[model samples]
Target: MYRLLIADDEQLEREAIKFIIEESFPGSFTICEAANGLEVVEIALAFKPDLLFLDIKMPGINGLQAAAQINRVLPECRIIIVTAFHYFNYAKEALSLGVVDYITKPAPPEAVVETVKRLIVELESASFKERLAAEREQQLQQITGYFEDDLLVLIAYGEIEAKEIEDYFAILNLQAQTFFAAVATILYPNTPGASILEIEKRVLNKNVVGWVKEYMQKVGRQAYIRSIGAEVFILLLAEENLDEYQARLTGMRLFTELKEALWKEQQIALNIGIGGLCNETGQIGQAFSQAKYALRYEAAPDSIISYGDIERDQQQVFYPYHREKRLYQSILQGDIHASQQLLEDLLTWLREHTSCLEAFQQKVYVGAPRQLTLQIIDCAGSKQMVGPAVDAFAAQNPNIKIDYIIGTSPELPSKIKAQQMAGNVETNVVLTGYDAMGSGLVQQIWERIMPEQKKSFPNLEDNYLPAAKAAFDLFDGYGIVFAWCPGGPMFTYNPDRVKNVPRTTDELLAWCKANPGKFMYPRP
Candidate 1:
């Protein structure tokens, strides 16, 4: 229902307008009246009307002044000018202030009713957007809470921005946990106007994230997710062997639902990889290797594959490591016939299984033209040729559907560099391909599976110390920078705002700027 306020210096005019409004738009609106600007302000505050019937001249403050003042307080209120003068200037000013209509005093009942009816449509739109904003804000807050909880896994890149992250963390104190780390790459193809933040916001709406959380909670799993890049993410969570498969499958279903609900016309496909399970919580570094190593298979015959899913039985003498030299020599030696033959064989292998970085590189160097092939030549000229070599690596991971080799990588704006990510939610992550299985980070991460503990908290400082350390390593402690992770919402640390922790420099500055006098001791 629409609420209206009539403010006129003359009591009779106010009464007249009110009666006309009630009669014309009967049961459609609630009416409130005021005699002056000050009274208008008071009534606007108290009554929260959706529209205002304002007289041009009034006692204490003229109609124009009152409308301007009230506009600041009640920006949503639609103004309909009721004045004695039908002067062009009055009409122009009404138009400028965005008044619904400038009707002369003693307006015909029909004119007044028509003006008000128009105002209602606009008021209704504004009201809808306002509700959407409120709901988005509340859901964001809940997402923050989910991430900060110790048992949940989390991954973020740029979507939320930094200040809100600090605010979120201040509200949700980070609870340390021992978990596995994995990344899910969400790919958006030729989506011109679509953005990671929009995707993140849409996912955070009613069903998507909530359903995933509920699914994990019900089955006793833990993970957190943030839209990290244009379409990528690095997720950290705790998982057990049996449950990991279930979690991955369930998350894939949620992803499908999210795309259908939030994405219109855009095709949302995900390449998810699972890092080897870390046996000890202190060895999350190993998971990073597993996660990164899992990235190797962009060329897999199938879309979703895991590090543990492929067979490594073929090669002797570590084909990914040692055979890399032979592969490079095979290409650089400029043996076109040999290179072409090797390439054909490699393509055949790719046709059979998903691509993993090491073997993929070896296959490519022996001569293949997947996008990364060019970067391999560039990196070879300057620096290290050992690990998978490329610039803007995602550019090489082609989405077969588009026939373009571009992976989502997040680039945060200057304004939001400091804010941290949603730190601790139980995120659902799936990675495919890379599998060297490196340092302690990845080792301990996927080793343990988290139990259902949304309502339960664990006390394991020693084990969690490393997982937290690994999370920061992946994305400065804010979260992993996966494509599709929203860019703006980074976390910032403020003693006063214990909820959020800033992840980058700009986010910290923005927070300080927003909070006038708050001092961050570390910065000073």
Candidate 2:
């Protein structure tokens, strides 16, 4: 339902318009009346009408002045000019004030009814568009959160391409030119008399992490916080042109405040370990390791430890960043011998330098041997266009191979599912339409192929159109449609046969009605 205000100096004119509206659009609007433009402005402010009809000639404020004032207050309200005179200047002024319709006094009832109905249609359309835009924004936010979480996991435990990280930063609008990792551990002593269940402990730790994340955001800090263990949360503090000493101080101050807040709110003791600064995002794993090593030196509760304080030469020969990178590269090249040699060297260095060789060996092993061949299944009809680009990408990256598979929408998902169930996932990526995969197929494929919680694609939105990115929303974060070529509903006509072709659906319908059997379109 909508509200409408009709204003005219002549009482008879107002009644005629009101009667026409009541008879034409019953129950559609609740009507209000005003005798002059001043009364129109006053009633409009109090009533907040959806539609307003105003007469031009008035005693005090004119219709144009009242419209300007009403528009300032309620910009969404639709206005109509109801005047006795059909003056060009009045019509122009009404147009400038964004009046939707101009009806002369003693307007035909049909014209008045049609004008009101048209405005209603426009309002409904605008409302629908707003709803769609809001839903799209919400979906994009969810996808963005997933992307950020995936990137953080890769930076902490796995390796990712530098270009891919840059693309992610672009999509997320993060200015993380430099970063350092920190590990926050909750100190909860298990008493001999009181035992806490494992699940309860996990929940408590999660709450603490959430509280810290909220605090960081409230204080306008550029940080990414993720829970990597039962009671351990990893924070990647990022900034532009980061100063090492200043970053360390900032980390210390942040942890201090968090410790105080947690103690006061939940009586929780927290210890934070700060790592060395890393200029490259790829080296975040190294920073994480340093932070973990620093955490070992936190002697007291609610303590803060920096790796630089304990270790004078922070650049140890056994540092896994460079060695692990090399090992990954070697594995990607299918060089078993070089990868084995590097692993052996790293294990030997760990045994000589660290007392906890087993733990360090596990970390090295997790980081070293993950080289995958991505199988891309393109179900869309753009394979012929994108095939050469795929080949060029493969040529550039000699270490990785891409197997581009072209298949129909019906065949690809089932084939991939079969391969997955058989314990062999030949298809690692899929390029298809939004509805290519059947319901629940994406979840099944994701569980089988990426069980380790790896991302299907890094920064998927940065490489595709927003509409195309939205198509992958149904994938449930399992896959992304990186490329799309829209194909449907093409119209063709010969200029000699048809002049002034219709461009819109309504126009086409009208043309068809006028031409009878002469105009034809495909049923589909």
Which runs of model 2 end up more than 4 angstroms from their true locations? 1-126, 189-192, 236-240, 313-524
Error of 2 at 57 (Å): 66
lDDT of 2: 0.69
The candidate 1 region of ten consecutive residues with least summed lDDT is 408-417
* lDDT string, candidate 2, 353-427, tens digits: 785566657876766445658788777666787788888988887767787767666445556654533334577
Q: lDDT at 347 for candidate 1?
A: 60
lDDT of 1 by residue, 466-514 (tens): 5443442543221221223224433445567555665666665555445
CA lDDT, every model vs. true structure: 0.48, 0.69
RMSD of each: 25.1, 19.5
Report how far residue 392 has shifted in candidate 1, in Å. Answer: 28
